[model samples]
Target: MHLYAGKKHQKYILNDCPNDQLLFAMGIRNGLTVSIVTKQPIGGPIIIRIKNREIAIDKALACHITAKAVT
Candidate 1:
C-alpha cells in the first residue's frame, strides 16, 4: 500500500473506494487505527489514526477535514 503524508496528516486514497469498504480496507492496510469525528464542536480537532501513528496538523486540519466532509 502507498502512503502519502500531507501537511496535517498521512493518508492513502483508494480511488473509487466502495462504500464503507474504504474504511475497512484502510484500517487493515494501515493497521486498523482510524477514527472519524464528524460532529465534534468547532475548533475541536478531529482525530484520525493510522498504523498507531498520528497524522500531521496540516493534513489532519486541512486535507482530512475536506475529505471527510465531502464523503
Candidate 2:
C-alpha cells in the first residue's frame, strides 16, 4: 500500500532484516515512530523521517518496512 505524506506511524518489523544491518545500528528498530516526509514520483524513493533524521529509501527497500497509521 502507498503511505501518505505527513503521516505518523510506528514501523512494524516482520523479521530481522540482515540486508539493512545499518538501519538497526542507526537505531531504526521496530516500533520506531516514522513520519512520511515526502514521496517521489513514478514509484521513486520515499523520504521518511525517523529519530529526527530524514532518510530516502527506494521502493524496493520501502516494501520491507511496514507501519500502521497513528491515531
In candidate 2, stretches whose alpha carbon ends up further than 4 angstroms from where it belongs are 1-19
Residue 62 of model 2 has an lDDT of 70
Supply the TM-score for candidate 2.
Answer: 0.64
* Residues 1-71 of candidate 2: C-alpha lDDT, one tens digit per residue: 33333343434222333358766666666666677767788988877776689877777767766555665
Indicate which candidate wins on lDDT: 2
Count of residue pairs whose backbone atoms collide, per candidate: 10, 0
Pairs of residues clashing in candidate 2: none
Model 1: residues >4 Å from true position, as ranges?
1-34, 37-40, 55-60, 63-71
Model 1, 40-70: lDDT tens per residue? 3454444445556553222222332222211
Native RMSD of candidate 2 (Å): 4.2
Model 1 RMSD, rounded to 1 decimal: 11.2
lDDT of model number 1:
0.33
